[model samples]
Target: MPPLAIMPVLRFDPAAVAECISPLPPLEHTTLYENHNCSTSSTKVLYQIATHHYDNGVFEMKWGRVIIICAIVLSIQIASADTLNLTAGTYETFADNRTVQITANLTDSTGYPVNGTRVNFTTDLGNLSASYNYTNASGIATVNISSWDIGNATITAEAPTATNATVNMTFVVGPVSKIVLTSILEGTVNTTHLITATVYDKTAWEFANDENKWRIMPDVKLNFTITPPPGSTYNSANITPPSNTTNKSGITTAIVRLDKCAGTNGINVNVTNEDGVDVHESKTIIGVAGAPVNLSITANPYNVSANGIDTSQITGKVTDVFLNPIISTGSVRFNTSGNIITKPLDGTGEAAISIGPSIFTVNVTVNGTYLDEVGNSTNLTNETVVVFYTEEPARIVVTADATRISTTDIPGVNESAITAAVIDRWGHVLSNRSVNFSTTLGDLSSTTAITDANGQATTTLHSDITGDATVTASTLNDSGYEINGTIVIRIMNESFVSVITNIEPDPVEPGGIINVTTVISGQGNITGTRLAAHAMLALDRSGSMDPDYYAGTPLDVVLVLDRSGSMKFLGSGPEQPMTDAKTAAKVFMDNLVSNAQVGVVSFSSSSRIDTGLTLLHSSDNKTLVRGAIDGIYASGSTAIGDGLADANSMLVNGRGDARKITVLLTDGVCNAGSDRDCSNAIAIANANHITIYTIGLGSAEYIDEPLLQRIASETGGTYYNAPSSSELRAVYN
Candidate 1:
């Protein structure tokens, strides 16, 4: 017989089943042990317990047919684990008691629908309409969420029996937060600008479809309008999608064309949302003026000196065709014949420039570009400013190659070259100037000459007469002032005169008239006649001449000096009659011929021969005379007679063959000596045939002029009256 067949008995409860199934641990088999207790009459019951193994961790019971039915029921109650996907139908809503719908879909791992499962909905920001819900046959559960506060909220759908398996959704609730407009606000006049306005919902979400295309909310519309500034117009003809309706993404765009206008302008963009509630936003765009169309320049103090400090102001202004000032800051370029200066224009549109020193007169022209506001520049504009310079003559200098010239025997052979130099105040040469040349006693080669690069003008002077001639150079300055320079040239005749001497009856007897004659002759065709002769030099030597008077050559002569006490006070300083007499006597000696004889006599109350008549052929004789002259001093009374007598005695005793002459000089009348009267002395000189030259020194009251004149006349000699030491030298000469 076949083994006894048995079925397993299993029981299941649907209410006790978990929402999710957990994974089973690895196992080989399961075992069960049973203890049976039965009481029966006439028949014994037998029982067997067994272990079962299955691949799915389910135990197979072999008991009865009811176990199969129980197994099927338990399998149906233990549902498979599933995932829940939560989605927000609308991501945003108004916070004013508005609600957002959240939907949750439950599915198995393979994406099959899981039905009859309880799903719990929760939020971090708002309250859900239903905290718990069962998924429908389609495995979808939906709930409504609401919040009083304006903020973002997270919605979660979860299965209680599934570990960490949940679905999340994001939602926002509030009024319109902000609006953004995108565009380049700046554009040239008469140009168009593409402006876009993007509207953000209460959740700052771009409401769009899955294709990134905007989805308009129910009954929501946007109004795009642009308001231009005064004196400016806007054109909307280029705007696409003619209506001002927002696309699916709550974004709208418009093309705004600006009218021609200068200076700053504003374009306002305003957007209004008409979706059951009034929501609005605005944006501003700035417009700028066009490029410069016209430029003008002006200058102040057009004329300036060449000095480095002189400056001029050059101003320039830039504007558009509408004549509106550009408000931007820019630089103006300035150019001139001299230095170039560049400076930025101030708010008033002006610049200042200057130049350095100039050597000569010059006319400067200035040119430059005018820059307008906003860094726009116009074409070059130029203006001329006159800078005049005046030159003045600082000085005029005249020079002559030769100071002296001979008479023009041969036209231009005997001449002098005269040069005149004209210079500026700073000593710089002034060229191309006219200088006039004129002469007093000579003829010039040219009357006028122009200065060369070296500032010099020259002319030749021809001597006309035998005298000094003056050459004058004159020039005119810038101020019409005349400047002059002069030089002198001396002219002399070529001919000169000489003397021819003749002596008749040689060795004439004493006391006899000797015949001597001097013939005047011209060496070369002389034009004038003149004669001169030597004379006896009578000088007053007193204490007055000792104070180092003017120098003179020593001559060969006899000096009759007065040594009286009155002579000391007769003249000034060392120029008293006695001292001056000695100086004058020395001058006379220096003028004498070398072979001539000289003697010295000093008289006071008495007379003494300081030096005897001696030939001046040797230097020793001159030294002896000088020594004797220095020895005479003032100490005694005046004795004019003794002085004259002693002079005559010395002359008469000398060589007879030589010309005998006596110099009688005295400053006072006879006051001492027995022969106080000079008549005896004069008579003795006449007897010896001696020529006497008389000089009366001192004032008229001191010396006896009548006596001296008589003595000179009686001896055939001339008488000289020397009132001063200077006249004494002249008389001696």
Candidate 2:
């Protein structure tokens, strides 16, 4: 500011304060002015001038020192002036805990930072917070709090910055809690549905002001609005999920529960989605009713052979069923015979089922089951089996069809009649049913047929029979057929050979011949001319009758009393012998003739020749008739033919069609007559087809089978040893 004045000082160093003072104008060049002024005028003038120069220089130096000191002071003041500032934010605390941190940073007002400045603490997080924090070298201040809650608290720092002097922030502490809602799926009436808008409030967004328009959005929520068929309602108390969970999946389940309310038929519901719209659909469940029934049966399979071709027999009775039978009137039809068969056989005399297909059905009645041969009656009202038949094999007398010993016919004889007589291995008849010959290549029928006694026909081939024919006999339907069966033979072929004559018994004719010459002659001879009869009359007569038993043993026999037995004694001619035993003898002969050939052996103790086996003959049926009448008187000791050999012999060899037989009639025993040779005679008679018919006169005890049989059986006849006169008549008949 004053260089001129300071120039004097400018030449100086501050270290020369002492030196400048030391050159003090000469302190007092002192009083020199005064002294000089007094001494001389010129001296006075020069003294004044020197004094002025000194005064000026001294003033200038002094002023320069003052300027330099002032400059130095101002530089010192600028070097040390700045302030601290602080900022605050974000503090956390427990729910209702109200504890958090408040911070304020320090810096100067012009934006220059200041460190180590003191700061005031804040509020806002819950209830508790620190009041102050020093601004570290970074100019930041922080505080830890104990509790904070209540909400809407403020944190301010007083003098946190050198210029602003204070800092503040507002905080709203909200409830820090998690809320959850759980729900089940719901179904809709149709396939799809829309959602209505949904709203939620979450603690995360508690800071969002409601006045700002939207509620705080939650972390998760089972919030959905599914639109069902219009006007859909829910069965569940709450259309929305109850509070427990917050997952979206839960929302689906909730919809299902609601839809179910529409009825188990299926249900639908509506809900509001954040953006409402009908979109997805829910599904319904399924259920069951009850168990099913199992029906079964055991039957002959479709393809096998059984009994007849009939269904009834083929599929036999269900003899046993675990269930109840079908009942009618009073009985149950529960059984079958299990056989099907053809009927009415031909010349074989014995009918068999196998001819056709034979099937039998067992009859089932209310009582129980039995064979048709057993309790077999029609079961329309009583459950009996009818053993019905179907169309039968047309009875055709197949006679040598083209004659190659038709295997299709009778195997051996080229002719076979369609007959039910054929039976199966099972003994079942080839049912009276139809014969179905159904092979690809076979003659099923004869264009021409002849009817017969048996509703059968004689089949005449159109041209000739050939190739193969498969036949099934069945009574069932066109469906059924008889499978297995067989055939048999004729019965008239069983007969015996020789015939016999003559006996030694007293009543018998002596010769071993019966005179049928006339009758035989009338019938004509086996030759154009034969003289054998003439020669017979003159033949050797040495052949006397052999003893019926031993030489003249009386024949043991019974005689007719005057009762019915006596009727035999009244006859004449061939029956004339009845006069002795009376008509009873003749009647006896008639009866004997029917069953056995009889040689008349009349005896009365000592027997005599009456009509011998020679006169009695089955061929000379007249002789046989005559011999029956020859009778003996019942008197004296009963004699028995030890053997009726000779008389028995007469009956044999005398038969044409009649059985050779010897009949001995006596009222007495063999006591008077030797019974010795009787047995022998019996032997002889037996070999000759001669038998004795004996009748006891009265008592049942009078006749012994051994004795009678000896004469009768040994001779191939049976004895009718009657007991009383009444029985005697019966025996004759």
Model 1 stretches with alpha carbons more than 4 Å out: 1-144, 147-177, 205-243, 247-249, 259-265, 271-292, 300-310, 316-333, 338-365, 369-380, 384-733
Give me the candidate number with maximum TM-score.
Answer: 1
lDDT of 2 at 119: 64
Evaluated against the true structure, the overall lDDT of model 2 is 0.33
lDDT of 1 at 30: 36
Q: Model 2, range 128-219, lDDT digits (tens) per residue? A: 34566566776666765443223344444565114444333343322323222232233332222222222332232443454343232222
User: Each model's TM-score, in the order given?
Assistant: 0.26, 0.23
In the range 1-733, model 1's lDDT, one tens digit per residue, is: 2233433222234332221112222223332212212122222223231223221323333432111111122342223456777787677666544667788888875788767678887788877898988888898878888765557777767874344334343443334434566887566655677877666554444333332432233223455555555654442223333346556666677776655553244434444543445565555555454565655666556565444344445555655565544444555655554223345555554444433234334465667676544436567465645463434786788886656556777332266778898877644456789999998897899999999866889998876577888889999998898998898877666654445344443223222344565545453354443444432222211112221222223223457788888877766755566667778887888677555778888888877666677665433345456545765778688787777777787777777666777777777787898677678987887898778898988688878888888888988888998887556777888
After superposition on all CA atoms, what RMSD does each candidate show versus the true structure?
42.4, 40.5
RMSD of 1: 42.4
